[model samples]
Target: MVLLDGLADEGSETVVKPVRFRIGREGVAESVGVDVGWFTARGYGELEPDGLLRLSPVEALYLTKYGRVAVEDDSGHVMGFEELFSRLAEKTANLWRDYVIYMDLRNRRYVVKEGFSPHLRFRVFERGTYPESAAKYLIIPVYEGDDVVVEELLEYVRACRAMNKTAVVAVVDRRNEIVYYTVSLVNLINP
Candidate 1:
């Protein structure tokens, strides 16, 4: 539900600027199609003290593609979902899988963002909370059919533990359904 008009750009990326943009205060950034509530509710962005909603690139792309934000270049050109998405994807390690996990968590009403333990892409704050509290969980995305390295997963748990957050893996199926599991080091001792 976003409106596109008069957005043009010039940059090295050749796609109307780089993956990130220089959205003008009012001249460049249009009133978004989705209200600030849409981003706040999904834990994607925040309305700053200046009344401008600051968003992460991940949130911007996800919302632009699926949620309710529309993006255009500086010259009034409509930016398609795939068009923007492709640009964002170039910056991530596993773009498709990560985005799928991000959207899934957001759709479930949890406030999530991209600041978790290293190697993990998200820090899921408790429900109904947004930027006011510390994150509670760290989530790493993995496909059900993919080979998982247990040692690597253990490291994530250790790092999250040190940071006072729980570590979980979001296992995605072929149908894009997700299931979560905590990764931990199981100490074994003979009785």
Candidate 2:
């Protein structure tokens, strides 16, 4: 259980109380201190006239001093939080795939093939059954567009670097029915 104090009011000493709570089966508990100016910062819950901290339950769940969960879009959509995240992830993956394809085409090392489910796969140079090495694996999906993808890509790069593998990321820009691709080395061989 962890409790974070709201911003302190003018001339008032900020006091943070501790509490315990569980988020998606993970137990988290800690205490945090808040100064008058820092506690009153925007995006945080505010105190009420009655001296009780006023906070939206949803907002509380989404933002706090410890960690924050993403807030759903303001659109009055009917989909649940999990469903929205899933849809976002799918779209991001498609973008990444498109970017990879564009890069392959530009590099002339890969061609359009019709046998795969995604309708694309990188053709690595050198034959002999493609050695069981990390170099042989190209075009790993890192993310779709959400923060999850960013975190996953970071973790993937870290893991790959730990194993002495190079991590590459391809970016695609789509505008006015045109797709452009850019390839960049994500990081060196160091986790």
Candidate 3:
């Protein structure tokens, strides 16, 4: 994947990068070029039955951090952000009566809340549905004048660590005025 320091004013609004290999498939026991140990230590793995790797809805949502839409499977299939949001909204529409999305304009941090106040603290339970295993906050950093403000990012990581949940951060480089994408996973016991 091409990595850029920042995005250009024109071109694609959202970029999708494809993965090269399937996780858990024959001859693909490890995450391709990615550090599998981070994911494995956190209990995430491939869907053996379908030959698909399951990204936490939180991680999937984080792909939008870099103005990217979604991360593709080994097959090069791209799933858009709107589609992901629609699917989640559909699944939990009946259970939750309201939805609140938070985006910090200063830092570009975003969080989605369904049937809960933004101030309430929560923990995610892996292997469950949205709101069940969903990260309380989705943090993204947009390069401001000189440095990156990471308050929200730290908060999310801290929350995930305290709850023994996996924290995945998608880092986008926009230095070249061209958009580039990549993902990073950090296992936090206490951020």
Better of 2 and 3 by lDDT: 3
Worst 10 residues of 1 by lDDT: 3-12
Q: Which portions of model 1 show Cα errors greater than 4 Å?
A: 1-42, 46-54
Q: Weakest 10 consecutive residues, lDDT, candidate 2? A: 22-31
Query: Best candidate, TM-score-wise?
Result: 1
List where candidate 2 sits over 4 angstroms from the true fold: 1-107, 110-150, 175-191
lDDT of 3 by residue, 15-61 (tens): 44433222222212222344333333333333334434454343344
Residue-level lDDT of model 2, residues 25-112, one tens digit each, is: 1111111222322333332334545433333322233223223322233352333434433444443345334434433442353221
How close to the true structure is residue 170 of candidate 1, measured as C-alpha lDDT?
A: 90
lDDT of 1 by residue, 1-191 (tens): 23222222211222222123323343223334334543454465656666666655566666666524566666656567687666555555576777788888877778887764337878898986667888998997888989978888777788888988888889989888889998766679888
The per-prediction CA RMSD against the true structure, in angstroms, equals 9.2, 20.1, 15.5
TM-score of each: 0.69, 0.26, 0.27
Which of the two, 1 or 2, has more TM-score?
1
